[model samples]
Target: MTETKKTTEKTLRRFTLSWQLALGMASGFFVIFIIFAFVLSQILKQYYGRLPETLYQWLGITILLGGLFVFGFAFMLTRYILRPVKSIKTTIEAFEDDPMTNVRADRANVNDEFYDLVNILNRMIDRLQSLIGAQQQFVSDVSHELRTPVTIVKGHMDLLNRWGKDEPEVLEDSIKSSLAEMQRMETLINEMLNLTRAEQIPIENVQEVTEVGGLVHRVFDNFKLIHPDFIFTLDDDLTQDANVKVRQDHMEQILIILADNAVKYSLDRKEIHFALSQTTNRVEIGIQDFGEGLSSEDAARVFDRFYRVDKARSRAKGGNGLGLSIAQRLVKAYGGEITLESALGSGSVFTIRLPLQRENKNDQKLSN
Candidate 1:
């Protein structure tokens, strides 16, 4: 019984807007007719005798015609006003049914109000499509990356299961191989988590300030101690230390990623240069390495997640290819940008540009 009641209510509520508007107009006309008849009767009885039957009939016919015209006009006007709304509804429904659909709301001949609404809807569709595409690509890449390590580990286990465990050397080699692959997988998963965190910096920590020069110096010193064979030089052109609105740890991580990349790619000339400078309103830090530089195409896409110029070499060097991507995300989160410059023979220089924090109201010009 409850189901039947719900079905009946749904059927009744399924009336379209046009019909509902027409019914409302008809009801209004009925009220007006009753009021007019009451007034006419009172006036006629007060001043004259009863009217003729033919005259009453003619009056009724005139009112009926007027009501029909008004009802039709109201229905047509309602449809015209709701045209854009219907178009938007239809497009959204289509998109919801099939996310891959490229349909967008039509904006032609719409009023200013609906034009803005349609524009916003179109922009939202574009953003959603972009995010969907990126998500699909990321999933595909992750699956591809995991397949090799997973296969290697599984193959070794199968070997050990098939009587290889009886041989001491074979069992030991298989165990080592499986452990290495598992370690690789663990590293890849951790880097993925770090990339996710980089994309979403906490809003409360956005105002955290760090001294740019001090952090750079610390990174430089640490790397020098770690890689003593390589030549390291620091060119600090900033007369006074500059401050930026970013967490110290985040800034240090960015520096470390770039510095580590510089150290990794150096082949013959094991030299790294750290340069820090400030402009009127900005601070710039650059890491330069005399290394195996990249081609134009490689430099363009070097910061992309899981992108490496030489995939085999990067894997051998224990790089999961998420470092630069994480650095880029962190820099942009704090309203800064990182850029790269390199050629086939010449080495690369990765530079980070950030807005310098103002010390006080009187501070205007920054020392070059």
Candidate 2:
């Protein structure tokens, strides 16, 4: 009963501007009628059939007085009705001047609708703040990561040129180091460019119906060719079903990034495992490596841009640290999720979960 009464009160409070204006006009007209009735009746009784002219004067005065009163009352009602709207306008102007300002209305004295709107605006501002913070952090990380590699390449080249002929072996190693650093820098720049392009383009630009198994096999084949020393294996439990709706190129890039990371970080360089599985509603692809796995803290930040658990080793192995970050972004762009599981001294597994297209009921029945 209390809830019902509260709901009815809420309904009554939600009056539109037009409805309020109409009500104010009606109330003003009712007041005019009351004044006219009282004044004309008194004037008619006072004259008592003696003089209609005297009654005419009093009737005119009554009409004039009623008009004045009604106008004044309506003016006051309009001002009262527009007060909250004007306050909201002023608050918005202040927020525009400084987006970080926590400007909020006094909810206890305002309409519930206005109060709710202010709450939603505050929430939106909070989200914008978080996004801006993340962008700033990304810029800082990129600058630091890129600067170090460029500095190393320059230093090593300078040394090789100064004493290259006198110390041939030293000069040769310096050149190799410089070349490796340059390649690392190139990879980092390319990964960052790909991430930027992925964000700039529309989703429809890259959407396609791709064969998941075939794409994985192609990436694996490329990886094997590039890293001839490492043994790469593909387990094809998932590729049998061919109805996964995803961008073919994007999926291949994601797979390559994961496989490359696994191969680079594996301890024994024995084998890297790639497997695909399909469920009723989803498909999951996992890349597992038997490496010196990440600690809990490192695992938590593994996908962060330019973050590496073993920074020295990452530089030595020519990793730019942007591969996982790019892969994560690409997977998320397709309404998919990427997850990592790892433990110290154990292996790491990265999983990508993508939604599977449902087969039409008619087609399924026909096939059955």
- In model 2, the runs with Cα more than 4 Å from the true position are 1-95, 99-135, 153-183, 196-207, 239-245, 359-368
TM-score of each: 0.74, 0.63
lDDT (tens digit, per residue) of candidate 2 on 1-368? 99699657645654455347756785768676877677767876787855568666876677678766775676676656556665665556566777656675435566665777766765666656555655665577679877987899889878877887799997889889898877877777777777655544345555477778778778888888988888888888863665566677778888988898898878875678888888877888899998888998999999887788888898778776778888988878777899999987788999999877667899799999
Among these predicted structures, which one has the highest TM-score?
Answer: 1
* lDDT, candidates in the order shown: 0.86, 0.76
lDDT of 2 at 258: 89
- Compared with the true structure, the alpha-carbon lDDT of candidate 2 equals 0.76
Which residue runs of candidate 1 sit more than 4 Å off their true CA positions? 1-15, 29-62, 105-131, 193-214, 238-252, 278-282, 329-336, 354-368
